[model samples]
Target: MQAILEEYLPNVMEIPDEFIEATQETIYMTVYTSLIAGVLGLFFGILLVVTRPGGILEQRVFFNILDQIVNIVRSIPFIILLALLVTVTRFIVGTSIGATAALVPLIVGVVPFYARQVEVALLEVDPGVVEAAEAMGTSPIGIIFRVYLLEGLPGIIRVSALSIINVISLTAMAGAVGAGGLGNLAVTRGYNRFQTDVTWVALIIILIVVFISQAISNWLIKKVSH
Candidate 1:
């Protein structure tokens, strides 16, 4: 067994340290991007709901402008958006070719997407519940927090999970542009160097990260629902 093990060790593919670092970068980008995007998305979503026609704080002007902004931003493909935001990214992060620089575009690209999801989630809340809250003389702010958000918590969790998954994909694309992550490793070491083993390893690691994220999201949904 020792003789066979020694023979196999030489044939085994060694994982590179950069690949490991890239994986960590991907995780970091996803986490911080999701957190910032989630908060901003939630705020914008609430504004969209409250400023709509016949809504609690109806304002045609505000709603039209905000709605148009979201639609316009969401229409741009993420890759193009990333390129378009290069100047912004450089200004914010002092560079546009690393995980930190990648984060700027990641958060910006996901914000409108997540905002639409949040709007849909909040809209799913029963109007009757909102009316009841108003009947109790609950302030608009109170209803937004206590009724809309609380009742929509389950839906919010689901959408948030979806957004996180989307961000993971985005990070992979960001990696293609020299954003240090699994995607970059796959491109540079795996594809460029003809290292199929490295490619497969990176793919597997990405899948594992995605699976864990989904599992945690599902658990949170169940826990909060109960």
Candidate 2:
């Protein structure tokens, strides 16, 4: 049985060290990008919601400017965004290639996307709750943190999960530009080298990572909703 298994699945069984490194890089980029994007997105999203007309702190000018910027950024495709930000990436990370360098573009590309998602989530919160808080003399900042964010926790978690998954997908595009990761390994070692098994392995690993992420996110959503 062992001999048959080895013969049939030799490449899959003997995964290379570089593949492990690629996996680590993928995880690193995804996690850090998610953290950075999440924070920035949350800030922008709060501003977007709270600065709209009839919001707790209405400011049309600011909201319009922010809205336009987010729309412009989100419109750019990820692959082009990665190339377009080469200089910015080098300036920030002091290099234009590798996993660390990929983080800059990853954060930039995903920030607007996540921000929009977060804005939608926050907007879904019950308006009455916000009004009640306001009637009780809750400060704008206090109401934002308490009523909007806290009440919208479940929706926020859902969008956050979706954003992270999108980030994971974007990392693949980043890998195309010498950002070493599973995507790079699959492209260079699998497709380029004709190692179909390696490609399958990389894809399977990606699926596993996404599945775990989604499962955890779903569990948290359930717990929070309850």
- lDDT of candidate 1 over 125-202, digit per residue (tens): 999998899999999999999998999999999999999999999998899889889999888888888877667778
Per-residue error (Å), model 1, residue 43: 0.8
lDDT of each: 0.89, 0.90
Estimate, for each residue in 67-158, the C-alpha lDDT of model 2 and write its tens digit: 99999999999899988999999999899999999999899889999989989999999899999999999999899889999999999999
Q: Where is the poorest 10-residue window by lDDT in model 2?
A: 5-14
Candidate 2: the clashing residue pairs are none
Candidate 2: which stretches are off by over 4 Å?
Answer: 1-5, 12-15
For this target, which candidate reaches the highest TM-score against the unseen true structure?
A: 2
| TM-score of every candidate | 0.93, 0.96
RMSD of 2: 1.3
Number of backbone clashes in candidate 1: 0
